[model samples]
Target: MALRTRAVLVHRRTELDELLDRHATRGQAEFFLRTRGRTLADVESRHEAAVSARRAVAASVPSDWALAEVERADLDRFLFAPEDVVLVVGQDGLVANAAKYLDRQLVVGVDPEPGTNLGVLVRHDADAVAGIIAALTNPPGRAGAAPSAVRCDELTMVRARLDDGQELRAVNELFLGHASHQSARYVLTVDGTAERQSSSGLIVSTGTGATGWSASIAHDRGGRRLPGPTEQALAWFVREAWPSPATGATLTEGMLGDDGELVVTVQSDRLVVFGDGMEGDRLEVSWGQEVRIGVAERRLRLV
Candidate 1:
């Protein structure tokens, strides 16, 4: 049987929604913003634009295909099918967040406000969504079809797995660090060498995430530059590795090849692992737990 073309629309909360949640009412939110020298009209205008773009995209969906809309916070709970075409209608961060849960599905990043926001992942504007979706559902050489104007680029991802079977994937970077502002204790093993170390945290980053946290570390340390977004290798760095009698700071930075892996044994009582800057949603490991970080088998197909 042929695969069904189901469109899954993904979005995040608007600025107005967040403000209202904190203040409890529109009047209260406006008052709170006024105290900060900001106007409520600015928030309302941006919210209206986002809503309009969402409605326009919804109207453009094919009537014969299955359609589903999901919020960013509920992405982990939602079940994504293999044949689903995911449309992320938000910032670039949302695309990175959605990439973790997705398998091989084709994702199109749609920027609601093309004039105001600049996005690296969300390259397409709202006006081009209909054409992109139509081309994706029906490619060239098919009956009653023209050549597809849509193009897809594959991005590498990073994966982390615990010894007990829990795992997480990230399109940007994975942060293994202490739960609070303190030193994180762990045993780092890479390339047949193991060393005990205490540091601020560990960052395992994909090529796609090189421009973010990994880039900063590379610049400060004068280390090797990161790979491109489509490269298969990953860069690992230990942030502020502190040397001590019990913990050695050697083997703090290196590249992880396609077949290579980084093993970290948790010595801290409250060590957390999170990806794509979503620290609130993280995995906690106690002393003696082992976590392996490496390049993931799956890649993000961006259309």
Candidate 2:
């Protein structure tokens, strides 16, 4: 027997609802719709779409919980693990990832597009998940790869060392910026020496979040650089010479670490750091406080 069973995971994009069938309970489907100024019928249509898609992938788990307004952290509460090897179907959000990382969890990825998980770090593809399952039940080599299986293409899934000698694996990305919005006066230090933060932010990413925030920071780079290119990690800095985009409560920078650990630096008059936007002990980011990131010695994945 294998150490653990393999599983498959899917994510909910706005269009995920459309992929579902009728008579399916609306599972967080409307939340994916980004269309602004929608109509009543439009809202109903979105709900219908989400329900349909969910049905195609998952059997509805009847529940009386307050509507589809569930938060991302609780996305996986519905799916029933009837078997050792299960497939999680939903959009590419916290819920989907949460299941993959949970105890006794294995991940297999599926998407409408063949290479949908291209830029992102997938735990496993449908084929990989299936193969592991098959290897457990049947034999090896004969088993095929899962449909959602796609190779991850990132640059830096690095292990960065901060001045404190604390090394963290940045599976997605990492960076530092203003702790508070009040005219963030930051000094950048790369490799060891100090630099300058002319802009309002800084960012680092793993292969997972390269497309999200890193793509935004590099937006001015004319897209020459794709997502990630460094298994050792490459860094970027954003310094707004004049004024910041907004004031108080603005996300000055973001750091995407391994295992979906997101570090966002928000600055108003106070410099605060958040873990995946979750509140924590507030601290100020000074030019002296050491900060660093990279890949971790322990690597965890699903699929």
Candidate 3:
């Protein structure tokens, strides 16, 4: 069969877009920014850059191939095929947000703003998109193919599964905590040993997510540095494990091997499980529900 090169463009709303949506007018949005000591011109320029980058990417897509545009918010509802080549044209977080919805599709992270934004994941510029796509779809050995040098790096992922058969995958980390500001109650189990605990929340993170919230938790608890982004193991921490007569704090920090798993039974009325900082998209576990977390079987292939 012929190659099916489908470019799935992923992006999120800019500050200007959000401002206009909230204030209902460009003038009102400008005034709102000015009141907060921010410049409307800066927001407008950023928005323009993003638009330019998106247009450039759209133009670069091969005319004979398929193309689809999707916003970050609709990722959960979008059905991604196995042959789709995803091109995320936004911040680094957009790449993380898109990873959970994908299986083994090749993803190209395009940095809309090159110099102004520090993009650890969105490393390529818009101008390079055409060449990347060409190389990926048509290898050098194939007929009517171009000389291309596209490559991909594999990144590990974290997977969480509930006893009821619900599942969630995250490129960064998984947060198991109370839905609100109240304390979370759960029984954490590692290596067959279990402990009833009450504290702030539970964070199970892969190596890719170690630089963010997981790093902060590791620093506060004097834990070791997490593995690399492509590593198979995961590190987990219990945030603010409060000691009580009914809840123990002995099992607070540890590493979960590839074959190993960490299990948690909900003692609270409701505990939320979300990945990659997208709290709106989450799995709710009621009291008596069990959740198992481990390194995911799939890995992200970044081209």
List, in order, the clash count of every candidate structure: 0, 61, 0
lDDT of 1 by residue, 79-152 (tens): 99877888888888999999999988888888888765546688888888898877765433332222346677
Predict model 1's lDDT versus the native.
0.87
TM-score of 3: 0.94
> Which one wins by TM-score: 2 or 3?
3
Report each candidate's C-alpha RMSD, comma-separated, in the order given.
Answer: 2.7, 9.8, 2.7
Lowest lDDT 10-residue stretch of candidate 2: 60-69
Worst 10 residues of 3 by lDDT: 139-148
lDDT, candidate 2, 1-303, per-residue tens: 312222333345443334334424444333333334433356565555545544543332212111122333444364533223334444344322343233333343333233444223333333343344433331233222233433322223444344445443334444344554334544443333343434554555544555666677667656535434344334443545444343222323433333322222222333333222222322344345545443444332334
**Which residue segments of model 3 deviate by more than 4 Å?**
138-148
Candidate 1 segments exceeding 4 Å error: 138-149
Distance from true location, Cα of 14 in model 3, Å: 1.6
TM-scores for all candidates: the values are 0.94, 0.49, 0.94
